[model samples]
Target: MIGRDAELAFLRRVAAEARAGRGGAAVVRREAGIGKSALLEQTARDASGMRVLRVTGLEAEAELPFAALHLLLRPARHLVDGLPWAQQAALRVAFGQGRDEAEDRFLVGLALLTLLSDLAEERPLLCLIDDAQWLDRASAEALGFAARRLGADRIAMILAARDGGNGAEPHLHGVPEVRLAGLARPDCEGLLATVAADLAPEARDRVIEEAEGNPLALIEFAGMLTPKQRAGHLVPLPLHPPQLPVVSRVERSLRDAIRLLPERTQRLLLIAAAEGTGNLDLVLRAAKESGAGLPDLEPAERGHMLRVADGRLRFRHPLVKTAAYREAPLVQRVAVHQAVARALDAEEDADRRAWHLSAAAVGPDEHTGDALAAAGDRARQRGSHASSATAYERAAQLTVSPHRRAARLAAAAEAALGAGQLRRARTAAHRGQRLTDDPPVLARLATVAAMADSELGRAAPAAHTLIDAATGVTASAPGDAAAMLATAADDAWFAGDAWFAGDHAALRRAANLLESLTPRADASLAPVIGTVRLVDGEPAVGLALMRAAVPADDRGAGTIVGTYAVFSALMTGDDDAACALAAARVDRCRERGLIGELPHALQLLTQALGCCSHAERAGSVGIPAHCGPAGRWAMTGVSVGVVRRSTRR
Candidate 1:
């Protein structure tokens, strides 16, 4: 914590504010070995009376959905029972404690928030997440979702993550950040003096200089020195070469330390690292399978590489785990994964076992690929879309058949889209497209790519892609083709007036295609038909269709069709209908714990409120334009100011 007074003060203030019922969160970003974890520990120690919860991300569990969250909330599981039934059920399903798999991902986040708030009702809560960069995508997204909405609750979160390295947590982007740099020269000298008091002054100065103020480097490099080197009788090798980053050097030093341990101990350490969950029993079983035993772990413990407590094993630092796993030969690593997979309960831990099996495989194996694909299905059912994407992608890699590979890639693309990973969805879709010529698979991939493109603001191309996909699917899958046409019309609307003015072809084509579909009086088709009518200059028919689509109750109000109805009402100058529909959407979203939809719902509500002369209330509920889809919609002549002014007249 040396040279971190300012950063400490910021974290302390956040806790203090939360203690006073103003909850907040801060993400601590820094390179490895720069004391991010140390700072988190210090802050936790400083929070005297607060309820503390911690989750340390493990590399082995990075692909397992909700692993980090499961660790963080294990102690607070009892509090979840008091939450609303929807939230409670969501949490149960997410944590694998229930059979119902219809949990919404956002509902899981909401459940976490509620549980944390309940825990903080009696005492302030401090959540410390270390090595957040290694957290699974589902865990990271859920944490971010809850963290962003912390308000008037005695809860504070501080997430420490590595930056400028692999495994960046992009989901945590919107949270407030406290960036850590190297310590100052004076602080580094003082720290070195404490750790290496008897070192020669010249040698100490050289260590301090070479460490570049990185706390781990300072400690580990000094620890590596012999008495002769410390006494200036022998010069230490310059391990911190300019070409290698300090963090890399520190990792190498840790690996070297691990190499000094007994071979059996190293094998035990590798099993522990590969297990990732710190399940002592599982690790021991896996180690025994590799001819290592509990006695071998003593060397690792004495070396300060890892510790065992409460039947669980934990590495001293994330780097220790990384070094242990990476230092092992590939054959040994694969054998460890296979051992761990064997140790897992076949029925209960199928997902983890499948992942390990996939990791252990060196070549195409249809059985393993099928196992991973089933795992992907389970992840998707649990609403862990990112985890589903990873499982499917790995399954695709292990599949020898081109058609199976393409199908898995399509599933991955769709799952990635659900997880809000736009670039990954697009890439997977493109790869799938190149692998398959089947019309159905190609249509699915095209649809996924188009949806991703639309979200990424390539609306014109997205509209064209959707139109083509719909055309390809029309003969075989008329229902899906109609849905695609409807989506194409929505994309054309998202393209805005500028694109509409420049080229009316995409809109005309969408309208023509929808017209060609078998006539149905379904409410789901109202918005698309209304949009087509508007494009064809029949405002009366469009307005009537939009009005018919606006739901009379909450049951239908929380749907995408309802969202389109609100927008259509606004576009057709029906402020009263827009306001009512938008209000209902917001309320339904909150009541159902649909957090992903809430932001856009709130935006629409704010706009509707603004149009109804409740501008002050709108301001209070308003989300920044850039933060929601409303900003893009504003380009289509439905801006707040324009609506407000028109209504005022």
Candidate 2:
């Protein structure tokens, strides 16, 4: 393993903070053969605790196959090993071949996680999944779920991957990265001394210099050297030989793993490596068209055939894939590809449809146009909206018809909007509408653009245009009107100083518009409606109404309970308790990234600050009286205009 004391020190600090009931993340990166795995292993060892679950990357796997996750989190199975048979059976039914299984899996998984957290002796749970680059899409999703669901106090995760040479690895960017560079010269020399003590000083220096202080390289280099700089077992090293390529080592490991698999399995895996997605139906058809036979072997001996529920499956790692794909012959690839095309014709799966369409549409001398469009439609139905958008974008690029391209952009725009991607929605809407003057489409495009600008605090020219569209639309399409109102609110609320600069009539109009659009149900508007009322200079009525609205909910008391406390505490001059309750409320929202509630937090903090100032000695220059200095003193800018932004923007 690569030893870098400094990198380990940083990871330790993060671990320490987590131990002390805080959360932290670390990211690590380096070129191939730079001892990334070595560092990961060391960190994992250091992070050992009562519930340490480890998952490392495999070399060749399908891009996003679901079953690979079964390998990563098999530990979750044992968690149910001791549960009652009925519960276990119910769980099986939940995570198994039925739609309802998803709910059971989640609930049972949550219960198990909670139990584990409570039962663990003293050590915290550390889930380490390494070599994230080759992670299956399902595994990535599981990571997201686990991050939010795992024990808040006892669980932390460690992920490791090689540098993708741009920024950090995309998958690992959400958490922290702990980069693993080359070892220091002293560490390199220390490692060498373990292998061969008292080597010539010149040779040791030469080894360190040649390895660029990379421990693995120095160890491998030292092994291949002689007492002199002459020829040796692996290759004679010069006094100053250049660093050996680690890719070759990675390459050899991959080749060996592939060679060891059964011949039929290897061939199928090799074909899948080239296919990229390795989606079963497509690969199987490719094999059939290529005239490859499925051996009619017995179940016990032919486990590879059913290793995953999906017959045409991916291997576990990208390195395994790179090795096999690099070695496949051209003639074999063409035959398998013919099979793939035939499979696309036969099967009706959505992801496979998109994949096959993508493959055929872009391939040499193939007519990709019509098939690509057909596949794009199927892709959207399969809940692969993002993938469908990609297919449509490619169609836009390859097809010559302006009308067809506009249609493609429209599909892409809808997908973007459904995905909560406002930026992409704005772009696609703008482009698609520009190419088509169809009034309805134009109106839709105008609505999208206006909402996009307004959401980000900019004034838009399309508010009235969208309002016109909403009125023209059918009664069944009230959604359009609702969207337009929300967009207008967003624009007005987020307009900054421009909002305050409106003329008297304009201010009254905007105020009425906001009041009309705000949620009418008292049940929903209790805390926040009262909040705006107080801010609008009617403090007494606002406080009384909010106090009446507070009720005990099973999910914890609603916002009104906390708001009432802050208001009452401020009025009664209980500054310390007021600040404490306000801070706690703010802390809870902050944890949820509830930026919409920040203005409420600010208002409460402002009141608490006022009470504190009133109690302070007159000579003291600290927290001032009134809401002015109080708001600033209590986490300035922490919650400014959050509620106002939602209503006005």
Candidate 3:
């Protein structure tokens, strides 16, 4: 397939080697619709005369009997069926039911393995099992036993499966595994032409992408598309059209498999699909929210999605979710989602909780709405405005009342303000104000609008907006009073109150009033606190305030320390202290790949310590022994400004 040529080649080589009795067997893996079967089929066709044995798996047949290994051993039945009936019956019972006659079954199974072993007396015997994800436990154990005993023998085996399934074959100790994926563009194009010849070259290319390099899906999806969607650009479509879903031949296999799931499992899958990927735990938790006991979901057999080595969980397939969700009645789907939203809301896992609540209610649930709002507030405090906006949007989805929806929208705008996404902020603010008639909220909007300007460094405009918010709104309102004071404090700090020679006394009064009026302490106030003290000629005070707001062991504390260290090095004469602080902050920054703070710290520290200064300080201490870019920049900055180390001049 597309990016799996290397894996296929390696598998074939291993199988051929085992067939030639030159080496041990091999193993391969891949995800759903990744051509695992196709590779095995190709291998089978290529080894037509090599005593090949094939076994296929089925969703319905998995629990019935020894269907899987029996399929693989079917070709050898010429020898198996001829065995003594009593022995055969004993073997059959053993094959299907593990506990019936352990010794007898084991002996019969051993006899069958002996038969296959003898069938390949001189020539190599190759066995291939497809849909190994659903391989029966009995069949799997038999294969494992056979595999274990076939070392250095003229036998090879290949088991193809959807890589991460509950029924996936157990790992083989010596046998290597190869995973399959989608087909190459040309292979896909060829397949497309064979299936649907009317597609123009451009349409053909687009079909290529719609399939996600999945050959089976590409062929199936092309059959259902209307002329309009399939007639254009060769680029990938972000969202599939409602009507033109996967209609390829291979897609039918997956569809049939999903049809067997119970209604509750189907509902569970659909809700999960709406939340997107890597959400198994969330989905399972939310699926239980229906208040319908596990008995109700008995038809929908649930299985834990194991974590892949790459650190992500996957549903058996996206198609399974699509079928399950699309098949769910709309009213039922919405009701279940609402329940899941409530459950997630009750829990404190903000990020995923926001997602579940958003999809579940889609209207209003007080608990879900409140939880989303809290999550949004938390995101803003952490300076992740993007996440804040997302949280606020989820809150909006849970807001049935227009007024509440408007408030949620406004909160999103507030988050956008800190992120400097002015256009987005303005859109949210406008929509919110239009929907709500609350005067206090209008006044708050004015204040937030003003803060937006201040953040962009337009201080004069910022002051005018602040005054408008403080006076234009009701003065007696406590929240407004506190907000206005906070705005005043921000303006005074930005205007450099400590350095303003003309109005030192007046500036201090405004700052003091704002500080006194500050209400409902939250992490959101941490940045503002640090900003004020840093500008008021109190770096130590600013650092202390930030530390108080962010716990010592928290991720945010490192960021606050970093900001203060940089500011101190830049505006004061504390090179050595700055160097040490910056070095620690840089390592933290690099570990998390934090932007904004790391570069600033580096630039500041670099200016305070030049190369000669470093050399002198390093007399024997030598570069802090654990330096980061901040230390290096400090060295460069000092060297350039003092010793003419660069050609900038």
The candidate maximizing lDDT is 1
| Best by the TM-score measure | 1
lDDT of 2 by residue, 1-649 (tens): 4367777788777666656655444545666556666666777778745356676554333222332444544666655544433334333433333222221112223333333444333566566666665564334434543444433455666666666531113334466666666677677877888876756776677667667765555655565465555222223344332443555554554555456566666667656765665566656566664454445112212432223354645443344466776655666555554455556564434344444444434342224555555555544443334434555666666666667677777777765554345787779878877787655566566676666655555554434445455444324344444454334433433344665432232222333433454453224334433444554567786576556544332134345445654655555445666676665666554433344455566566655655664544211322243335534545445342232122122
Candidate 1 wrongly placed segments (more than 4 Å): 1-3, 98-104, 165-168, 236-242, 494-503, 519-527, 530-534, 537-587, 599-649
Task: Please give the RMSD to the true structure for each candidate, in Å.
Answer: 5.7, 11.1, 20.0
| lDDT ranking, best first | 1, 3, 2
Q: What lDDT does each candidate get?
A: 0.80, 0.51, 0.55
Model 1: lDDT of residue 546: 70
lDDT for each residue of candidate 3 in 170-251, tens digit (9 for 90 to 100):
5344556665556777778777877878776777776676676676577556655557556654344433553553333334
- Number of backbone collisions per candidate: 0, 31, 20
Candidate 1 lDDT over 1-649, as tens digits, reads 6799999999999999998999999999988889898889999999988999998887777877788899999889778767777677777778777787744567787678778888999799999998898888788888987788787689999999898533337678789999988889999888987888988887888788778889988998888887878887666555567578888888999999999999999999888888887899999888886688889889888878889999989888778888999999999999999999999975978888998898899999898899999989888877899899999999999999999899999999999999888999999999999998998998899999999999988888998998988888777887777777777777776686574552257777876776677664244666767767777688898778776765554354324456677777777777777777776676565555655665677666766665654444443434333333455245333232222222222
Which of the two candidates, 1 or 3, achieves a greater TM-score against the reference?
Answer: 1
**lDDT of candidate 2 vs native?**
0.51
Q: Residue 585: error of model 3 in Å?
A: 11
Q: Would you give me the overall lDDT of model 1?
A: 0.80
